[model samples]
Target: MAEFDDILARAADGGRIEAEDALRLYTDAPFHALAEAANAARERVIGDDIVTYIIDRNINYTNVCTTACKFCAFYRAPKHDEGWTHDNAEVLRRCGEAVDLGATQVMLQGGHHPEFGVEYYEELFSAVKEQYPDLVIHSIGPSEIDHMSRVSGVEVDEAIKRIKAAGLDSIAGAGAEMLPERPRKAIAPLKEPGGRWLEIMEAAHVQGLESTATMMMGTGETNAERIEHLRMIRDVQDRTGGFRSFIPWTYQPENNHLKGRTQATALEYLRLLAVARLFFHNVTHLQSSWLTVGKAAGQLSMHLGVDDLGSIMLEENVISSAGARNQSKLGELIDLIRSGDRVPAQRNTVYERMSVHWTPEDDPSDDRVRSHFSTIVADLQQKA
Candidate 1:
C-alpha cells in the first residue's frame, strides 16, 4: 500500500511512471485508490469543474473495404451485394442535416474502397467545404491515408496535404485498434504496421494537420500490450506534440471474427482509464467511450480522470454493427454529466466550448441532438 501510494504521489508531483510501473498499477492497484489518483491527476491538468461533450455526427460514406480485419463487423468485402457507397449528393445531404440539427462537426469515416483514391476524397471534401463551409470535417485516420496513397500512386504526406487542401479540418483516430505488433497483427493483419501508423501520424502533424489517437481495448490484448500502446503514443506525442486527445474505447465482441474470446469488464476498463491518466503525462485530453461500454461506466469515467465523454454520436454505424447499441439524447446526456456533479459543456470538433450549461435550466432541449442509427443498421433491423 505504501509503495503504491508513493507511486501515486510521484505521479501527482509531476513524475512520469515507466511502462512496468504502469502495468503494475493497472493490474495490482485497488480500484478506488486508482480512481482517486487519476481524478487528482486530471484535476491538476484540466480542472474538474466541467466535463465536455461534442455535438457531431459520424457519417459513414461507404462500407466497401479490402482489408478484411478479423475483429471488424463494420466493413463489407469488395463487390459484395450488401456493400454501398454514398454518392456526393448523399454525403452533402447528410452534412446538411448535421448543420440543421446544430452539429458543428461531421466525422466522415468509411472503408478503403478500391476505386476511391486521393482524388475521390479531394473532390468529396472540396464539395462538402464548398457547401457547408462552417462544418469542421474531422475524417479518416492514418490507415485510410495509407490506403489512399497506395491507390492514388502518391506518398502518405502528399495524400494528407491534398485532403487538408481540400478542406479536411482534422483526422479522426479511426484505425488504431491496438498499437502493439502482436495484437494488431492478430486482429488486423492487412493494415499498416503499428510503427508505420505512427510514422504516418507524425508526417500529418509535421504537415500541420493535428489528429486524435485512439486504442480499441478488449480485443484479446494483454495488459502489457495495452501499456506498450500507451508508451508508443506517448513517445510520438513527446516528439511532435500534435495529438489533440487520446481516446481509448473498448472492442465490442459481436458479429465479427474474434468471437467472444475475451472482453474487457467494466472494472478492467476503468482500471486502464486510471492507469492511462497516470501514464500519459504528455497527452492533453482523455475521452470516455460510452458508445461501447455503457452509460454507467461512462459516468464512472468522470471520476477516473476522463474530462470528455466523447460524442453523442448523432449517427454511428461501426460500433453499432458490433453489439453496442447505447445511445443518448441532448438533455439526457447533460443530465448524465450533471448527475456526476460536473458541468456539461457543448464542444466543437476542436474542443472549443460552444456553450456552457451552468444549471439545469441552462440545458437545451433540442430533440434533434439525439443519436441515430445508420441506414445499414436500420436496414438490418427491418430485415430481422
Candidate 2:
C-alpha cells in the first residue's frame, strides 16, 4: 500500500512511475484505494470539473475482412454469408442521419476487404464530404492503410496521401493491439507489424494528418509489453506530436476465435488508465472506453485520469458485435460525468466543444423523435 501511495504521489506531482510500479498498480493495489489515488492525480492535472464526450456515430461500412484475426469477432470472412458491404449511398445516408441528429463526427471503420482499394474509400469519403461538408470524417487505421496499399499496389505514404486528399480527417487507432511483435503476432498474426503501424502513422502525420494511439489489453501480453506499447507511442509522439489522444480498451472475449477464457479485469483497466495518464505526459487527452468496459467502469475511469468518455456512438457494431453489453444514453452520460464531479461537454472530432451540457435536460432529444419531426415537416410541405 505504501508503494501504491508512492506511485500515486508521483503521478500527482506529474512525475513518471517506472514500469515495475505500474505492474504493481495493475496486480496488487486495492480497487477503491487505487481509484481514489488515481482520481487525486487526475484532479491535479485536469481539475475536478470539465469531463467531456463527443457526439458521434461509428459507421462500420463493411465487415468483409481478409485478416482473420483470432481476437476479433467483428469481421466476417470474404465468403461468409454474414459479411456485408455498405454502398456509397448507404454510407452517405448514415452520415446524413448523423448530421441531422446533430452528430459532429463520424467514425468510418471497416474491415480490409480485398476488392475495396484506395479508390473505393476515395469515392465513399468524397461522397460523404460532398453531401455533408461540415461532418468530420475520422476514419480508418494503419492496418487498413497497409492492407489497402498492398491490395492497390501503392506505397503506404501514397495511400495515406490519396485518402487524406479525398476526405479523411484523422486516423482511428483501431489496429494497434499490442506494439510488441511477439504478443501482437500471437493475437493478430495477419495484421501489420507494430513497427509498420507506427511507420505508417508517422507517414500519415508527415502528410498532415493526425491520429489517435490505442492499446488493446488482456490478450495475454505481459505488463512489460504494455508499458512498451505506451513507450512506443510516447517516442513517436515526442517526434511528431501527431497523436491527438491516447485510448486503451480491453479485449472483450465472446463469440471470437479467442473465447471467454481471458479478459482484463476492471481494476486492470483503471490501473492502466492511471499509468497512461502519468506515462504519456506529453499526450494531452486520454479517453475512456465505455463501449467495452460498461458505463460504470468508464465513469470510474474518469477518476483514473481519463478526461474524455469517448464517443456517444449513435451507431456502433464492432464492439457490440464482440459482446459488449453496455449502451449509454446522452442524458446518462451527462449524469455520469456530473456524478464524478465534472462538467460534461460535447466535443467534435478535434476536441472542439460543440456545446457544454450542464444537466440532463441539456441533452438533445433522441434521434427517433427528430426523424419523426422531419417526416412531419416534409408531409406539411408537400400538402402546401
For each candidate, the alpha-carbon lDDT, in order, equals 0.89, 0.81
Off by over 4 Å in 1: none
lDDT of 2 by residue, 330-371 (tens): 667778888877888878777777788776667665634221
Best by the TM-score measure: 1
Which ten-residue region of model 2 has the weakest summed lDDT? Answer: 369-378
- The true-versus-predicted C-alpha distance at residue 343 of model 2, in Å, is 1.0
Error of 2 at 7 (Å): 4.9
The C-alpha TM-scores of every prediction are 0.98, 0.90
Question: Any idea how many clashes model 1 has?
Answer: 0
Q: Compute the lDDT of residue 349 as modeled in candidate 1.
A: 76
Q: Over the full model, what C-alpha lDDT does candidate 2 score relative to the true structure?
A: 0.81
The alpha-carbon lDDT assigned to residue 320 of candidate 1 equals 85
| Each model's Cα RMSD | 1.1, 5.6
